[model samples]
Target: MTGLVIVGHGTRSAAGVEQFAALVERVRRRGDLGDVEGGFIELSRPPLTDAVGALVARGHRALVALPLVLTGAGHGKGDIPAAMAREQQRHPGLSYRYGRPLGPHPLLHDALEQRIDAALTGASTAGADAGTGLSGADAGTKLSGADRAGTWVALIGRGSTDPDANAEVAKVARLLWEGRGYAGVEPGFISLAQPSVPAVLERLRRLGARRIVVAPYFLFAGVLPDRIVAQSAEFAAAHPDLDVRVAEVIGDCDALADLVRERYAEALGGDIRMNCDTCAYRVLMPGFADKVGRPQRPHDHPDDPVDHHHHHGHDHHHDHDHGSVAVVGGGPGPDDLITVRGRALLDAADVVVVDRLAPQGLLAGLRPDVLVVDAAKVPRGPSMAQETINAALVSHAKAGRRVVRLKGGDPYVFGRGHEEVQACTAAGVPVTVVPGVSSALAAPALAGVPVTHRGVAHDVTVVSGHLPPGHPDSLVDWAALARARGTVVLLMAVDTIAKIASVLIEHGRAPQTPVLAVQDAGLPEQRSVSARLDEIGASAAREGIRPPAVFVVGPVVALPTTGPTV
Candidate 1:
């Protein structure tokens, strides 16, 4: 006789553990196998050892260890297998085979799509129907065409230390949005990664999402997904007009149950097919090639392992005080576009002072207790006061908190990051600056208009158009810039583009020079406006382009498929 053991990355939450246990029970009730049991790799109750001993006692010689995780990450490929190896040494007579992680599979994708549909429909007709969950034709019927056009779906993954695992969730999000007609699907993380749910939700609001749904990629209800739910509520409360809803976790659904059984069958027959394509060791992933083929080494001290079976298990490695401020550039608009160093700092920070233009999707996935300071006040007139933002950075640093001042684009590229850096220095606070992909170049490139192209332009100049052409406070040499032979990328020039274009034309710059304006830069809602230098302002006005946009002037603006022509 053979027995099946379902191995889960156990959690501290009793409810979470119960959910996994219930899933195991559901699989057993189906009654297709002889003997079945559930166990944990770590943290929560009955360990895998207990499950193995019990099964062997129940007169079983062969067993299968099925890892119930979304990716073949450390837990799936290393930890679980290592633990199983230990058990194998203990029971020489018993034989067991390991199965693959449960993800990148079509069934998993189907479950996520179903979760999205249920969330959208449930919110649309919540109070009207009691106990109705996407029945019959309602499952296929979209909530509303208007809502569908404006809604954004945010998929929250239990972020992993392995970058490949973290990236898989993003791929899943993109695939879900490819053919579906929702406004967009954004990738978010719940733990150990960027683009937190709240950040993504706020970003969706800024990108004009009429309603947003946050769907967790967890196979069971756990602490991380619970935090995602709370973050959604917090964001909804903050922005009363924005409708935020959380979809169900991939619970003990039939699809997941079927997936578990399939893995069991595979493990029993010695047919484990691991995902090698995304494996860092086999594939040359940018920064992880050195990790290739390294044998799994155990680091858990048995006492201070990752899981503690208690609520206080997740302490974010802040035993020492980092009484300094890290000025992190968030890159253009996309969450994943930010550099790896910048993201790592965000995950470890105790206080994150963020700008409106920062990669907001990263915020939604932060630890539930991390203090997030909204620093988007307008510098001069409306919005958050820059003085206040500077004061917050200085104060937070002085208070001995690990502070991360997150800004959009390069900190020095018209982001006012230098001013904040200077303020911290003046306040006797240590500061470190992490460079990021500036919107100036990122926006243009994302729009298919590189600032400089081979044989098209040799040099590129980036200038802030916030002060207009002839403002006394402006330091830019308009006439000199007009004479340049390369591309000119302008930021903060939306309102004053007409004057700037006029000044360039007056300064002997070509009136017919190609111009491209990219709004909402690297996001899915990004729109491009293209026109000759003389008519760009009119074209921008006609197309309703907004600020935080970049305008590219020169032949490179014509590099992309002409955008929306004037």
Candidate 2:
């Protein structure tokens, strides 16, 4: 049977060492693997060589070495592998298969949720004890739905120099926030990255979160975890009104041990698939361009007996090829409305060129290092020239970075997405178009105004009203539209609704035709105004309805209350 060696980046703290050993014991207790041992590359206790030797002494020549890390950083990608290579030299005939880092896994997410729940429970108990005169078990209970909704989470990770590793933490935070009923979840680092523990906590407070839980995304008790707690305490003391609680690290639990076993099995089965798309050493990320194609070297451990000689001769020359660009439709307002494919692309993107009407909340979940170019074209205000935006997309894709041009609603619906696509194609860059839920249809539907009804309206026409009815550049057949009995949905027509209404009425459409204008449709601030075809322009203007408002005309506008069955 192949033995398992759990490789860890050793910590200075004795507690951390003990916890790591406990986790090893937990994994060993499973009994499927004949022999299991764990050791660190640097800092504390039984060095990697010791663990390898122990397994070797136990008659286990073939071994599976799994990195006990949340992300594939320098330690997992380079240091541990380099150290294992040295072991192969020492043992002469020993062989081992390296495993991928164990993180962004479902089991780890469950473990984090448990920790967060515990923190909230403990806080609830403390509050009960202070006021309700309750004690012990009676006081400790799960927080109510209201309490959970009011609280925000700050996921803290032992930050790394690798941008890819840091991004993994942000990804975890985003995953944790999904469907968990928290106010929000933001990622912060204990070291080596931006938005430190205190900084994230302050941000949470500023966002109107009274209760905050700082969940350390660590595997065991370590100096970093301790520091996270201390920093949280200091911040809590400073802002006495804020209820800040620190959740414990994911200590030696069965969930973690199970994950280790799974990793060990994967390593033995040669199922190791590392995500290199966003790796700093492979991808040319912004602010970390120097790391691209960089060679990996062994970390120097002060406690190790071997005389470590730094090797700089081994160089890896990777082809920094151009990455593909994705024109993703961000859907109407809410981030949750974005398509699964769109969200996935955004998650993998190195650069996101965002439009003004796109889901802005999605930006908070992106990696802190990602370059977000605000390509927002504010109505009648500052706007990014379409040429400049198109050039930016091609340039980023050519630079070996995944670029996402995030547009609001459907990219094809007057979003000028095709123009950008042509630019990318001209530059020899591959581009993909992911369709979104357009506000043109979504706005009217959300306002209880269906564009189509079996008996009420058989057809619906969508038109852009950016130009007045009589403008020289206008292509809309006002007379033809007026003759049609079907519903007409007008987008970007808020500014010139009066002229369009007059033209429609003059062209034989009834002046008293029911009209519904839905503004900021499918959003929390969504509001609707109702008037006749002739009165819609004046009514919308008087009600302060702005651009992005959808105007639905004809019998279908009143279908929600008194229209066809289907």
Candidate 3:
């Protein structure tokens, strides 16, 4: 049988859960759904993972996970899908399709309109706004100037870090105002990003709005909704005869229940809807032009050509889990060079699968609860197997653990990060990538050797030296690199530095070209040794240079850090 999983952004308020559950029950009463269950993204019982387990226990091999959100914000686009995908990974034979959020859907508009009408009716019946024609039950009843003259609405959204989601709130506010008889609809946020309630209220007043209805765009009553109501009360108290009223949340209405069924059906029928025409990946737009035509593969159909690397029996622990992988680049072996966001994610990670190349100091400083898996890959040496590492990631995430793939340097730059991403995605796992400072550029700069200089070098080509220049597996075009009158940066070339230098010299590079090698770049034990191209290999051997070193080969290496810091 097919299952319907409703995922809500959980709240601490018990009333919020009761309202959400009532809606879930309303949907379940529909004869079309089988084994319907609801869960929260955070802070509540029957989390997304448990919701899946409930359906699985009821003999549901196929399920549809629907998001109960108003917009495609972080929760809708990332967290909910990630949690669902990770849960899917746990139940191998089980297949599921994810549905988008309830919002921006026409039915949502209808429900919100209903809430507005109910608020207006209550005020009208109570004779609060006596002269205001907004008192009538008939929505189409023409409003007098006294009614529309200073009437406006302030929509309260749980403002998000995602700009697009916040913009949607503003857009919906405008859509709700069109021919709806209210003076205007002002958009405001309950918290986080953007126009606060007080600010939006003040703005509305400036725009000639006298009477206002503060409507929270939340699906259920929660602490946020309570705060919205409290804020409205405070504002009303501050302004005498303001005629400000707080509307109930978008509660258990027929429209909302119907929309949940619609989303579920859409997921089953593959009729998922979101604003995709303007997606940055599809069309080149300002500030996002570079992402043009990139393959945006979120949903993996059974028909997709894939290579699955993971296999497991009914190793049953229907535990609370959401499988996700964060591939983070730890940067040139230093904890300090890690980005602020990277550090935050690291601190929040439950399991950190680290590479041998990542900063060892950071590992020592990690929270004691963090389970560290050493995926330490050594150049031509013993290390964690790539397949096993991929499996470990899947395993931990399926067990409802957050896994961070911590590597040295930028994950995509010869770090085989793309492979990890492919692995996780193929296994129906969600992956997040965080780029770090590559040794290719950092090694050169920290050693006072600029890879690119205006008058000295026009380009900088980063190449891997894991294989010698003549080795068939080596992808570096030594001949082209040698002929180019620019800096050539080499990483993982310590063992083959001599042969690589010889190949470049043979391929037309000047034997007198200066070469500078920086070992353990960015580390306290950093060492920079310089020699001519012809003598670098011998000099490195004499200095007993090791792997995890970067070499800069070009005329720019001849320049010193003589220029002061900009």
Write down the TM-score of every candidate: 0.51, 0.53, 0.53
State each model's CA lDDT, in order: 0.77, 0.82, 0.76
Cα deviation at 453, candidate 1, in Å, is 51
lDDT of 2 by residue, 1-566 (tens): 89899999877677888889998997888898778899887766688889999999898878999999999987888889889898888888999999999999999998888778777776331111111111112324656778679879999998775788999999999999998888899999986666899899999988998878888899877678878888888888898788787777888888888888888888878898899898887886654543456565555455567874521111211112336688999987877889877887787777999999999999999997899999999889999999999999988887667789999999999899999999998876668888999988788777777788888899989999999988999999999999999999898898888999999999999999999988887777888899999899889989999967889999977654631111
TM match of model 2 to true structure: 0.53
Report how far residue 536 has shifted in candidate 1, in Å. 70
List clash counts for every candidate, in order.
15, 0, 5
| Number of the predicted model whose lDDT against the real structure is largest | 2
Off by over 4 Å in 3: 123-149, 277-566
Better of 2 and 3 by lDDT: 2
Better of 1 and 3 by lDDT: 1
Candidate 2 error regions (>4 Å):
123-140, 309-566
Of candidate 3, the 10-residue stretch with the lowest lDDT total is 125-134
TM-score of 1: 0.51
Tell me how candidate 2 scores on lDDT.
Answer: 0.82
